[model samples]
Target: MVIKLTQPPKEPKELGVEEFPRLGIIGGSGLYDPGIFENAVEVQIHTPYGLPSDNVIIGRVSGRVVAFLPRHGRGHKYPPHKIPYRANIYALYTLGVRSIIAVSAVGSLRPDYAPGDFVVPDQFVDMTKSREYTFYDGPRTCHISIGLEPFTQEIRKVLVEVASRYNRTHDGGCYICIEGPRFSTKAESRIWREVFGCDIIGMTLVPEINLARELGMCYGLIALVTDYDVLVPHQPVTAEAVEKMMTEKIDIIKRVIAEAVPRIPAEIPKCGDVLKYACV
Candidate 1:
């Protein structure tokens, strides 16, 4: 199959919209509802990568321009690996989203961070395989220069501040991105925590955050601690529990997003400026 690849229109933003969104959000599990947004409009965007996971919801939050997309689709149809990462990012990029806040539910890799905790990761380990990781893969080969720490520190600070501003109990932690529709086995969980020393584990995030960095977007994440992983002594980690906690954590996360949405900086400096000296 011959796929044509070229730079998308320069400064090409949707017509009739005179401004760029101050915030762009990719909602993972338990973040499908747009009811929190005032005067929200569902916008279907077709990108070169493919269809976005769902319609991009454009609305006002604390008077800031916010664009929201559910990475797993409206009903959470696609798994992490199956998600169309390219299109989701491209759609937001095309829309001129300068900063993105990704919200996801993760299993705690450490004892200190249990269910209900929120984390803003400073580093990421991409264990995600079998997913397209770039926007340029056709005739033109473009590389996204990145450092070890993928998430923007400036954005991270904003997220942490937002958590504090809302009186939301959140602590910064390291996030480990794993490939899965399945929870880790006990042995796998042990290796991830004990051996790898990752603070949290989740299926999505890897390519999603990486691509954000590639485009120089100020990207950050608000992680909802859903479970303690399968390593817990007798807790017997289960999908039902992840889902249950995810639903409950959604309220906390929704509050955090609502609080953070208004804080997105109107003037975007160089993308990845916070991580300027970090990536290798």
Candidate 2:
């Protein structure tokens, strides 16, 4: 069922985030939380790509308008590779979400990045076998820049600053997106860390970030470290341990989002005019 909230106030010339139409929050595993919204309503959004992973929740947090969606449907129905990345991102774009905050649970690959630490990744390495990776494909083609600056740096900075106030947060790192319904094997994990030089590992965040870029939206990821991915053969990471750790750290994630939502800038030049000279 689709539910809609009352319209928020008009954008003021002051240019604060609260005046924006929507600030999107894409929740990853153990992070489909909307409790921070004081008066949230569930809204179903049908997109040209398809239905988003689940109903989007729109509400106000820290006096800012926020839209939250569970990448995996409630009860965790979709796997990482199966998530409707195109639909989810397109829906947010249609709903006027200029900026996106992606909250994902990930396995750390570095010794310094311990379990329960938070990382705002600045770059991404996509290692998925299948998933639609772009908004423009055939009739017309356009290339969006995801090379030097994959994720939006401005939003990353806001996430880092906000998280620093509440949790141990790494300001920058590289995220590796793997195709997974299952955890990585020791060899694969080691290759990702040693060869790929990825600091954290996850399944989603690939096409989602790309699609956001195609449509000229700012995207940033807040990766919560739940465990070490098979890199340390001696320290086995169990599903149970990951769930428990993520559950314990959920509060910190909420706090970070609450503080960061209001800080998104009113405008970004990187995202502006993205399609102006890209289509060919």
Candidate achieving the largest TM-score:
2
Clashing pairs in model 2, backbone N/Cα/C closer than 3 A: none
At residue 25, candidate 2 shows an lDDT of 94
Candidate 2: worst-modelled 10 consecutive residues by lDDT: 7-16
Q: Encode model 1's per-residue lDDT on 55-97: one tens digit a residue.
A: 7877777777688889899888898889999888888887768
TM-score of each: 0.87, 0.91
Query: Model 2 misses residue 90 by how many Å?
Result: 0.8
lDDT of 1: 0.76
Candidate 1, superposed: residue stretches over 4 Å from native? 1-18, 165-170, 272-280
lDDT of 2 by residue, 1-280 (tens): 2453233223421122344456899998887765898666666766777788988877788887777889998888898889999988887776678889998988999889989899999888989888998878789988776688888888999999989888899999999998887899988988999999999998888888888889888889999898888867777777787788879989888888888888888678778566688888
- What is the lDDT of every predicted structure here? 0.76, 0.82
